[model samples]
Target chain A: MIWDWGFALEILPVLARAAVISIEATLIGFALAASLGLVLAVVRIAVPWTSWTISVLVELIRSTPLLIQIFFLYFVFPKFGVVLDAFTAGVLAIGIHYAAYCSEVYRAGFDNIHRGQWEASIALNLSSWTTFRDIIIPQAIPPIVPALGNYLVALFKETPLLSAIAVMELMQTAKIIGSETFRYTEPITLVGLFFLAMSLVSAALIRSLEGLLNRRTTR
Target chain B: MGIRTLVAMLVIALVVIGALATQESYQVFMPGLLQGAVLTIEIAVLGSLLAIVMGVLAALARMYGPTPLRWLATVYVEIFRGTSALVQLFWLFFVLPQFGVTINAFVVAVLALGLNVGAYGSECVRGAILSVARGQWEACTALNMSRPQMLRRIILPQAFVAMIPPWGNLFIELLKSTALVSLITLSDLAFKAQQMNQNTFKTIPIFTLVLLMYLAMSLVVTIGMRLLERRASLGLARGKAA
Candidate 1:
């Protein structure tokens, strides 16, 4: 196929414009995943039955493929009277999927708390809430910054899943432009390049965050 | 918490799912759910097989290849690991078709998934191999075994055992990722679910069924993997347990 530099250059604006949607989906999805994950982690930390049930749900979500979940959500939820829009469905699917992963991150955060912290809290006549808020969370949250950042990076990549639900994300924009121009090489190459650029920047940012966290921990 | 006591609760959960599934127009949803489940399996299996092969190749290149080859492998790993899988799939299926290399959706989906997961799995493979200890390599050389012979006889068996657990974890991940392939229009579980949802307009019932089916399929595979892990861990010391 003859490569069209001009065509690829033209699509750059279009793809970049659509990138906003992808970023939006990612942010919304991450927000949902973060909150849901924290809720489940808190429940798991507090109640055995809640934890067990949540574990089963997490396992189920984790085991099955993500594309399938997206499909189920986009295609099936309206039947029971919850008619979600493409964007909502996409965000919800991404949120639920990543929440499973984030829960593991949060659970790890929980696990990293020294046993003595809990014992000390009990010894001090602290309530469970006080123990968690004043002691456990402060200790547990720092190490998790890097892991949660990685998940955020992952969530950004996964925004293209929103394309399956017909959201006009970055990749979907590329596909449409490519088909419209009948010049795939340029647009496709640009997409790869675009993703590469984004990933590199995000990775560097995560590393810096890691460094910052490390410095804080040492102090 | 007792076996008989919890049985009622477990039954209730199943009943709830079933009840939710059928309290609306649902017959069409079952076929779609089953279809999506099958597609999910096919994509997961094919993608995972590709991932294993690519992973091993990638690990080897990273481990033993010439400088440039190792560099190339590193580039591949970093790019894939850093990006979202959905973008990769869209690029492969839709973007490539515009370039006049119109591959089938299934192939595109599988290749995309394979390459994506392979990048991650390569790390697992490398870690597993490295964990095999420098002592083993030293021991093999001390026995004066040929390099290839030593690798086959002394190192690979242990490495293979270590590879299985990591491979299983990657497989579970790959299974979940196969849903992205539906964007390419393959009649996988995700595609079927979407189709049925569109036709029936009973989205909740249909999707709920799909979720249950996926959970069931993944649960079975996970349990199977656990059993394999057990068998590998115990080895032929079966009679010791017996």
Candidate 2:
């Protein structure tokens, strides 16, 4: 494959702009997932009555493909009077999709919190909310930071699925460039490199965060 | 029954009723979706088989082969694992043609899925092998066993057990990922769903049905993997007993 420097230079600015949208989608979607996942995990643990429903909902979300979920939100939801623009629907779909996975990570962290910690909180007569806030979550979250970071990287790679709904993400921009120039190598390869760089950087960050957390726990 | 079980049952019943209520649409769309579903299964099965082969070879090369081979394996794993699968698929489908290599869509799907999942699967293989314990290697050496013999007879059998669950996950992930092939104009389940939606304008039922179809396929893969895992672990238990 021939590498065209001039073509690459021309497309760099457009691809960079699209990359910003991709990064924003990943960050926003991840934020939504983190909070929603925590809520799901907490509700499942705290309310016995809702645990079954929540678990089923999580499983259904996890089992289905994210593309279908995005399409359902973008296309089907409009018929149901819940119209969403491509970016909003894409982010919401991604957020909800990853929320299922994130909740499982949160659940694992919650499960790792020792029973004695809970009983000790009871002995101290702390409110349940206070117990979770003070005793459980602090210990639980540190270990899961690495796992959560994985989903962040995964979510970043998956942002291209938004292009299916016509969100002007990096992948879509590359496709447009390819169609216009009829030269696929440079634009697609650049997008791939962008993803690889982000993934490696995120992984390194997660590793250092894990090390920091471990040192604090040991100290 | 527990209240939890009752709630789950009620949800299942509602889904069943909803599915059945759309019997007419099901008749119209079922044939196309079923055809697409078959293609999806074909892609998953063929892709996973290719992935397992690539994973084993790459893992071996990375762990014990020459430095150049090790670097090759590492690069393959990192590049595939880091990038978007859609980009890879597009690269193969769109870009390869420019290089005077035009593979059909199905072959492109299989190659992309296999290579992508193989990248992830190699890690599972490498991890399982490394976890087989240092003493086992020493013992094999002490017995004057060759590297291949030791790996095939002692190491891989045990590692196979450990690999099953993660491989199961990879298989399901691969199955879900096959949906992306639809974007490349492969007429897979997702493509058929899109086509049906365009024709019928029954967006909710059409997409819902396709979603359920995918879920059903994933469930099947999961159940099959569980059975395979049980068989592998059973052999492990039997080996220990003997």
- Candidates in order, TM-scores: namely 0.87, 0.94
Model 2 stretches with alpha carbons more than 4 Å out: B1-22, B235-242
The alpha-carbon lDDT assigned to residue A94 of candidate 1 equals 85
Per-residue lDDT, model 2, residue B174, is 93
Q: In model 2, what is the error at residue A161, expressed in angstroms?
A: 0.5
Note the residue pairs that clash in candidate 2. none
Candidate 1 off by > 4 Å: A71-83, A215-219, B1-36, B97-100, B144-147, B235-242
lDDT per residue as tens, model 2, A1-219: 388899999999999999999999999999999999999999888888998788878867877789999999999989979889999999999999999999999999999999999999999999878988999999999999999999999999999999999999999999999989888989999998999998888889999998999998899
DockQ class, candidate 2: medium
- Total backbone collisions, model 2: 0
What is the C-alpha lDDT profile of model 2 across B125-156, one tens digit per residue?
Answer: 99999988799899999999999999999999
